[model samples]
Target chain A: MVAPVFDSGSFRDPDGHVFFYENEIYRTLTTDAVHRMERLLKLSFVKKSIIEGRIIDTKILEATKIFPKDFLVTEYVLWHEKIPYVTYPFEWTFSMLKDAAYLMLDLLSGLLENNFILKDGTAWNICFYNGKPCFYDILSIDTYVEGQPWEGFSQFLQEFLYPLMIQSYQGIDFQPLWRSTLAGIPAKLCYKSLSRSSLFKKGVFKYVYLQEKLSSNKTISEATLKHEFTHNAFSKKALTNLIKNLRLCLETLTVKSDQSVWKNYDSKNSYEEQDVKEKEKFVVEGLKALNPLSVMDLGCNTGRYSLIAADIAPVISCDLDPTCVDQIYLKKNSKILPVVLNLMTPTSSMGWHLNERKDIFTRVKSDSFMALALMHHLCISHNVPLSHFILLLRSIASKGIVEWVDKSDPMVQFLLRNRKDIFKEYTWENFQHLIREHFHIEKTLPLNNGVRQIMLLSEKKN
Target chain B: MNVLMYCLPLMATSTPCCAYLDAGSSSMLLQLLFGGVAGGLVFLKIYFRRLVSFFKAKK
Candidate 1:
């Protein structure tokens, strides 16, 4: 009764790994994925893709009532559920990776109309639970072997169509190139970063210049690739016309939003619609007196008080404008997760034993925080000093609400036009004496245009 | 160049395939032969425009 740990990113799927125990989330599997999870749970289209939340519901557990001596040569287990804050796909937002590449091509054209397929199209096997994009690898579906061509088509063109065709024909921002590659933006580095009139558009010369000339054609012919996997046979109307021309080339991918500086910050702010309804009634009364089960927000520009502190809870919003986190991830609010960080450069800890991917303040921490209008873009356009921005907002949240804005406000004199207000301790009594040396302020208000204020705080008991 | 001299004499007379079919299975067999002939000519122009709207609804 004590050995189930595993999950360091579920050890690259050898048909099943994920662990956890005593906090649940299981998985085990492997006797060659128990006949493809019992023919994908006797498919009634996997219970109508788990009642159309596009799969990820899973159940079967009893591996000797939970790992009896580590799944005694395991053959099934499963469980799952978890997902409340496991973001990646480089913290999404570009229509959350175009709604996780149209939910992995609508679950690979609904598991190729039932005879199953997806054996790996990894955008880390898709996540975003409540704000949609589901597909949590139920052993990455399998069965469809006949003329095995769609073996997850070049991992869905290097993780979801060349990172949504290089952010829709190079408007760039595929989150710092999927946070420096986790095997995504490749197709010959998105055909050496497009533009020759975006390689003549429309399904960009058959999915990226004929899949980058058949991936650099090394004289292809191993008996014409073993006669294309034993005398080619595709026909299910040619794999449903190759899943309707890959859903009309992912519905002609789009992007556009460029000139950003917070994409017209809420119709050029200076507030006053009774100062945005008194700053949305003081951030919905300090998120209803901190009933926080997770909140973050921080400069969430187009997420207007992170959709009023996501009606009191799951928020995470953040923003240093990737067009205001692609307009709050095109508001498909599964209680707002948004992203595109930047609190003066955030996402750090990075790859292989540098704690294999974690930092963005150790994957977004929050017991409540909101910051709004973000302290004059972190004290005068990022020179960050008000007591190291109140100790990085008291290491992001132990209850907060912040705001501030002064240096004679018109957006803090438009972040001190042509800079040089060497922020003589940017006053408001030196930001209330450097945020009362780590928080405890509890309510201050101000809005009907008294040049900005807010407050709330808390974390003092030390 | 004449399709790279006709694929280098069919890759020097074929027969060396299964290394777990790479280059993502030859670009998914050229995206299933060009997305199955442009999805069979858009599935025959969507059932030839629903068979000419069923002969203009039987006249």
Candidate 2:
């Protein structure tokens, strides 16, 4: 039998590590964690949370079955239900991150009521399943100690509150920054980046200005520091108020992007009513025929086709425009996972030793892909070669539906207006030839508008 | 005086305080103080409104 491979991302917590055996995910608990797990399992809230889908379901496994009996060092092992698609904070839209923050706060509030608290707050610990954020780390909760401050409070600020505040105030998207940093934007940096007028905002004075001042002050004596942690008593009422205030602050943060090209994409397009109906009919029929387990909709602006595809299978809808992704997320489609991703520069491996997080394509590859109205943007706008684009599609999915817009199309002409028309080979004939080299063309259909064509392709066998 | 003398040597000899409290402990301490006062005020506001409603009902 092959040895169980430990997950690269599960090494941070010393109490436990997740491993995969026979394609099944399992977590092995240290002796210390076994005791904590035993105590937590007896709690009614833990059981209720699992039932309500607020927490991932876990079943304890016999340690001897997982590890060689002589090699076993822990008393217990746990197996968890694998989420269909794991998404990172950097790929989430503003609304998705906001919802995740709310879920964390809600979980924290409930845990505190039951005399328990989270060990730390990291956005990575939460995953979206069934269109709602669910807390997955069973080991994160521990019994609350009297007079102990909320241990996760500061981390919550850096990982969740600060990023949201910066986006709401500065109108600068923080997804790229989060992707690069992985630890989240620091509170000090966020405070410095905000405008002077923004400091006067309702929660800014308390949460940002004061937090920055307190964190930077290094003159306090050791005695004072010890006193702060050991002597400070938090009444239950005060903790309740803290959670409520944080929720209210997050509730008021609303950022509506003003760059609305993709938000109004369907309306602004030159397609006639009959053209849209024909295109939709073709896509729906093609997807029904494929009947894939999961579909990845690349450049899914406003998720028009993604919503239609979700009825047959779960869909991962991705687009470069934050507003477009945010609109899809707000629609609350349970089967659709909407994310903000620029394909030209997708997220890469980052963190310790550059291997803590996997690259975008490695993390999410589907059996079927939909690249609707996305070819010209890559070939003309980004200068990606036609053959290279087809190769990437083949590498990411077994089957795909790709739309080809000939240079004669008005949209392609618009992309060429100011730029030099150097793409002389960007024609329908060349595109078909390049695509056929890697795929077997199964079907072809042209919309009512004669300038565009769609093709269904299956990867060629070796 | 004896207790102070005994404590002075221990304080001087001890290592520089770098006891590894995670990065956000200081902010969390400040929040505890602020949240206590805010929570008290909220509780008072709720009861005060209820008192006004009771008198209006009596009238």
Candidate 3:
């Protein structure tokens, strides 16, 4: 077995750090954390959660086998089931974050029934596995003390509740705000940004406005509240009611499904029925031949092709429009993950040493990808060179399909209307030459009276 | 600050401090208010629709 490498993103939690060894993910727990796990594991609720796949399945590792003698005796070792792909809150659609919030609240409510509580409510630990939200942090659960407040209350507000509120109430996308700061929308900032009229919105007055006012009012000494709560401890029933109230508040929130340019692209894209059939046929053939472990459909407008790829392998369908991506979840397809991702402005590696949170490029776990109708926008509109575009494709997947749109194509013409045509390298010959430099074109199919072509490609080893 | 302090009337009482996470004083204190019989019940009225939906799902 290879030496275990510590995961850079796992420094915040004191209980343990996650690491990778032998292609599997593992966690090293402090002895105290192991005791918490032991207590929780004995509960039928926790075991049932693992069986139902709401929590990531974990098992204590036998000390005699994997780790060296010294390391095993001191720190407890555990193996966690690895998720197929990891996506952050920034790339999530409104529905994705809402679903994650629901999962966290439900888990907390259920844990409290077993005399346990989640210590923290950070949004980072829940991941979408098979299009369902799954909580992965094992050490977050601990015995709930009587009269102690939900310790992660502010964190829940910052990470999940406040962000969703701003989006649903103000018609603003919270992704930009969340992407900028790890803590999510601050209560003060969120309250100030919200309109005074929104003070009447459901749960807004207390959860956001009141919470902000309360946090800033300084006179409410938290130390004093700590002492009082001990004397006037709340029953577990009351705490459960608080959780239910939060859950109910979140369920009422909604994001407007309007404001989408690509929401109806499948019908409005001007592709003839026969042309679409030809395109679908080409994608299916390529996927069948390669039979990749998974496929990522970049710029999957309304998930037309992602639905096709889902028939073959689990597909991560991504687009810049939340409305477009949200349609995938509405379809209720278990094989597809919908994410609101903008390729041109994908998030950079952030936090300490730029490794605490992984960059977009590294987290995409796909062996093959489909970039249908995406090249023209990246090259003509975004001004990325064809060489660099192909380079990105090769870096993302060993084999893939690229739909090359000619400069004369109507969509490309629309993108170039009344603008300086500085794309000298956008010609088919240049695209073919550039692609050939890095990849071997295995197959090609024409569409739309030869205005567009789909090429199956495999990266060439240097 | 004194004016606002008079209005809010801080502290239901003190509870033990929590773990590593910054449980922000206001958020922590609000829980005392929420855990009261009248408070969570009032909040539930705002989310009454959710209560309705929960029943619908059970059916």
Candidate 4:
């Protein structure tokens, strides 16, 4: 039987509360929702756009008896597989947001042709999958009727277009906007913040200003607010143009950040050319021996080592620095998933319904993991005990190949340059003992640098 | 497409005890696809089993 996967409290729609079932996701539609689905499925363009990859496709499946009493249920079609990693908007680079904006508009246009419209235009619905963008919420499409104003027009402006436009027109970063505001950067705030030059621009003036004006003036009646599930007037043409223009605007959106750190990291590492090559060789050989299909680089900085492992497996390169992750994304191909994650405070499962978002441990379980230059950060910066660190690493990957950087190492000294040395137990002997309890240490190779040592450990598979 | 979702559980390497509660990082898209197909099969199995039992009793 398909079990319940995720049920976000915020996603509790009166029409249908969606949930994942089995490997295929299904939405249990209420009796009223059945008509909406039937209407939406009737459009030929909808099918073509989705199948052609222009629009996010929502497939209708055969009926099932497992639905709630007041609901009619069917298993909706889903993507073949999940992407390697999920990067939140807060973590996204400027270019990534621009790409997402175009995707949302593309989907919206197709939905309009199908006589259906998106219920919401939140930026959170878009995810990068397989080098391209795909919509996460299939149920966002609803049956379109004549004369209704686009419900999510203002949201589309604020969440995606405005922030991107603001970044483009003004030099300010949108990161602060997201960190502070809950329901996207408000239109009034964006309007006020943007320069006077921004208002005169053809795309910005027509789309952002006019839409914001319409949204602010329009108000729902008290009766309609009481019955939230009731449908509104939907103009297919306006929706289509809105989507088309937004997409065109997003395609042209650009951001030139001041500096990217990882771009020049190859020249920055303390190791000599020979030492770097030796370290690379050791990591490549270890990965070849393990033959892992999935890998996680715990403290991957711009993915120099992660790329080596990526040759053998799908690698999720994690780092705390946005600049580093952004550079990796721009340089590397999309197959290598780069996520902005702090090893000390990694992405936790959070939301109104915690199940909506997966925690670091929940989302990734790699066949092999690499934590090179990672031990000192955990033991020194985060104050995580070596034993606890080993156990936490155990949960992330089946096997781990990590480096033990001695306190005397220049990198460790750099981290300790300012702070007091409270890491009394941070010794090679103590680390070996802690790791050996949970893993079988197969090999240890002392680096030519004389400051770092690499250890390969395999879990005792049941 | 619906059938494709059901095959993932069988395809996965290790079936963790926590698989049912939260199947790790399996995408909501994959989870929805796989979950729906798997759920549909179970629903049909019980649904048909009941039908067969009712018919046999009448016979």
Q: Report interface Cα RMSD per prediction.
A: 12.6, 12.9, 10.2, 21.9
lDDT tens digits, residues A1-462, model 3? 335678989888888888886788888878888888878877888889898889999987755587765553325677899887888887888888888899999899999877789998888879888778889998888888876778888888888988898889887888889989877888877888889898888777767865765565433332335555566666687778878889889988988766677777778875899998889998999999878888989999899889999999999898888778888877878899887888888878999888789888788768999999999989998899998898888888889889999988988999999799999878988888888888889989888887998999876778
Sliding window of 10 residues with minimal summed lDDT for model 1 chain B: B5-14
TM-score per model over all chains:
0.38, 0.88, 0.89, 0.72
Candidate 2 local accuracy as lDDT? 0.78
**Docking quality category of candidate 2 according to DockQ thresholds:** incorrect
Better of 3 and 4 by DockQ: 3
Per-residue CA lDDT of model 2 for A122-200, tens digit only, reads 8998888888788888878777776566777877888888888888988878788777678778767889989999988
What would the TM-score be for candidate 3 when compared with the true structure? 0.89
Ranking by lDDT: 3, 2, 1, 4
Clashes of 3: 10
Tell me candidate 3's fraction of native contacts, as a decimal between 0 and 1. Answer: 0.41
Q: Score the docking of each candidate (DockQ).
A: 0.14, 0.11, 0.17, 0.01
Q: What is the overall TM-score of model 1 with all chains considered together?
A: 0.38
Sorted into a CAPRI-style docking class, model 4 comes out as: incorrect
Q: TM-score of chain A for candidate 3?
A: 0.95
RMSD of 2: 10.8
